[model samples]
Target: MEFKRTNMCGELRSQDIGKSVVLMGWVGKKRNLGSLVFIDLRDKTGITQIVVREEDKDNYKKAREISQEYVIEVKGSVRERESKNSEIPTGDIEIVADKINILDSANTPPIYIKDDDDVSENLKLKYRYLDMRKPSVQKNLKLRSDIIRTAREYMYEHGFTEVETPFLTKPTPEGARDYVVPSRINEGKFYALPQSPQLLKQILMIGSLDRYFQVVKCFRDEDLRANRQPEFTQLDLEMSFANQDDVIEMNEGLIKELFDKYTDYDLELPIARMDYKEAMDSYGSDKPDLRYGYKIQNVSEIFKDSDFKVFSDNTLEGRSVRAINFKNLADKYSRKQLDKLTDFVKDYGLKGLSYIKYQEEIQSSIKKFLTDDILEKLKEALNLEDNDLVLIGADKDKTVLEGMGALRRKVAKDNDLYEKEYALCWVVNFPMFEYSEEEGRYVSQHHPFTMPNEEDIDLLLTEPGKVRTQAYDIVINGDEMGGGSVRINNSDLQEKVFEALNLTEEDIKNKFGFFIEALKYGTPPHAGLAYGLDRLIMLFAKTENIKDVIAFPKTQSATCPLSEAPSPIDDRALNELSIKLDKE
Candidate 1:
């Protein structure tokens, strides 16, 4: 209390021996070793050992009372430790105290402050403050800040203007459900949080802002997952008078900057590009993980004339059979394991799985149905080698792709076939519209603003499903980190695209009327991308759980355990908002 801290706990080394220092931090751990009391003092930087000798009776007594996470201040002289720790940066030195002060007392933490703690995720989110004390968690938070800072610097250097858009905006009919906020002032009106700054950013381009970027918060009331959140951050950017390649090159430079600064791996210029169809056909994903070699092969030709009903039936009418040769893993899987894999793909909506195993003998689930000629043809087509295990699935075109695509990734992961490195690429030329059974109409695959490819323009009306947009997604190791597309500069083209989406006059007028108005006013050819900031941080932080990179994240149910949000509001507040609870 009497002196301000002069040094961080982690900054001290053996060179600072005998240097009197004032250190203040939380007591990470306290140990009473009979003759000496040792405390591990922690701050955001790191941790340092604090020792109070029995001879320093007053300080020793004070140190004895310090428990884990108790706030403390130590006026100590840097001294060599009797034992040196190799694991920590400040491990080689110790702080021998002249005084030990308990700045603040603490209650026991509900969760352990260690990274390897086997606590439930709900409990961890509930006590996120305590969870953040873990060195790994703190490192993630710090890395997140550093990433944003670097992004701003790179964008500024590249002549991109950072802008902020409104959080409370109109609800769009397309995309994810909006998290709506009722307006108290307006009788029954509501404001939906921005899903992305998609429309406004284009309007910025229309307003002649050459290039714009925003490190903004966007919300969607979507189902939660390990890699998704209801509220997430995006590095949104747009460029006026830019084509697909122009936007790609500019963003590629930004990505190179971030990767070059943060990661050790050298990122080669001009990330590889792939078409939507190629990615789907070869890897079963739009964002394919190219680090490993289990590329999917279409075996429909060989299976078409076979007696196997599953394959023969699927190979008809534009549907086809697909297989992935998980090389040299034939012997690794038991019959039970293969059955489990079948169940796994079923979750992706496939009826079942068929597999051909080449362990010691050539065997398959449909081996009985295979003629010698057909078997030989299948082997030749797939280029099957010794010890190759071929996973086969068949269904409708879309179902087969989704199921087999998931299977490919699952197999690769289970076998450790992929490296944990960034394999970045641009998945380009996506479909302009995809059919939505729930809506019973076509919906914009990206958004209605996306410009269809010039070559595909005529197909917009007659063969709407065949139209490809100039959209592209930056995929890293099979994760869609960010994506955007060339905008529909012409108002007529935008209307046609909406019509293809089956949006009636009322739907268009209600949802995108203002955005439609903006398109009429000299909008330029533009393309942009919004990187999922949480996913980006995950790659940098080496964390798969989206919650790890976030300071306070909600559970899978989209509830914040720490603050108990979405709880019952008082009747008075509800009445002010002109809302009433529907208690059934």
Candidate 2:
């Protein structure tokens, strides 16, 4: 018999009543009585109920034999369901089967094919093809597609040309480690996957592409975390003769469109901006969630003259104290719970945690150490009220901010303190260089090509640590959604940035030789940004697990459960590539 789908299972509704429709999908489930059978047919869109009555003997017989996940085609007339299911989209209508074709049968699946199945991630990933059939999973993938299409369409309308850069390119000097592929004919040489197309995009600007964009794959052979993968997609973009303002302006439209299309919040254009230093000082995070009002407050002055040595010592130069008020959560946290909070900050390098319970009677961890005068001052600084809990961290500025910032976020999450669903802002004016303690040198905060602020350019060599870059990041709900910086178009300035990193002439020639050469060929003042496509989708999809947004994501250990990827290659294939395993 000929098989063709006249309509999707989920799209049929009461309006299509009495219309003959051909539907092909997997059997979501089957309910069989002695006379009748009701089967829920599922496609990627959704599930629709199909009724096979005893009167239609042949169809009823075939439907009765159907089991879960069995692929089948049905010829039926749409009819209003007497019993409506408010839960599903196609609940109002169902097909009354006249003909049925059981195309294939499926054995019991390893995992249930349903949303909210609550199976372990490994099992879901192992049977990813089946997992994707779930409506919830399919919706995320669909949203991912919509976002990419929106981005592409926006770029095209804005005169940006989509260009495909090579996947196998030279490794960059800055950022994460690269995933390298060994070359067969080139003996020991290898090709490192492009980390961000950072150099290539700038080279395009030099080549006068003017406006370039790529939905590119980037690989990083670094330690994987929950949201991070060994390989990920980047919405890579760059523009020539553009500054930070131009880049941000153009991107704001696309970002606004995405938010406006996907979210209910009315996002205002030219989204608010916060300086990097201000963000760190105010929230202890470069990417701060502005949805709530637990802003980090500097309380160093409150303990400046205190007898407590810990508070006084940190209140000195290069050290400081900070605090956050968990509004009305004081009595809620017991001593043991407070101890747990203390244990949490230890990972951030705090020796201890100090907190105040501003209840009927003011109680504090440092009650014995501080005079009542200092306590009063601290209360004033944090705007103390009844039932308030103030958590304080005192150390060097970096340690205090980071520790307190982390505590701030943790408290908000633990106590259900988030006031809004989405909070976004532009974090601008990042430091040009950050000192890497392990490397014992300054590295680019964004990348080597980042152009320093006009005034800060003079401070680049003299006060490299203080120099600010013309860089910006679009931070959404405390995640760095996307970031970019103006490129150092002049070859001499580019070489100087390398010099500031203490790179030897040989290091410069080998690592960035081609990029430096490209800069010499009339490079334009270009800037670009790349969004973590997966993270963006995860945010809009409202899923905390990044794997929820990816189709076949790898585990935190960077291995794919579906294909058993990273499996060993045959020894003959290894030999052909001139590779040998040390296994040491």
RMSD of each: 1.4, 1.3
| After superposition, candidate 2 runs with Cα above 4 Å error | none
Cα lDDT tens digits, model 2, 1-584, are 35678999789777888899999999988888767688999998788999999988788778777889999999988999999999988899999888999888899999998888989988999999999999899999999999999999999999999989998787665577878899998888999988888888888888888999989888888898777888899999999888889999999999889989998878888889999999999999999999898898988888887888888887775588888888899989999999999999999998899988988877888878767787688678878889999898889888888998899888888988899988889999999899999999998878888888888777777889998988999999989899998888887887788888888999888988877877766777789999998999999999888898888899988988999998999999999999999999
Worst lDDT run of 10 residues, candidate 2, spans 168-177
lDDT of 1 by residue, 31-137 (tens): 88899888999999999998889988788787777888999999989988778999999888998889888889999888888989999988988888899999998
**Which one is best on lDDT?**
1
Assess the local accuracy of residue 193 in candidate 1 as a C-alpha lDDT between 0 and 100: 94
What is candidate 1's local distance difference test score? 0.88
TM-score to true structure, per model: 0.98, 0.98
How many clashes (backbone N, Cα, C below 3 Å) per candidate? 0, 0
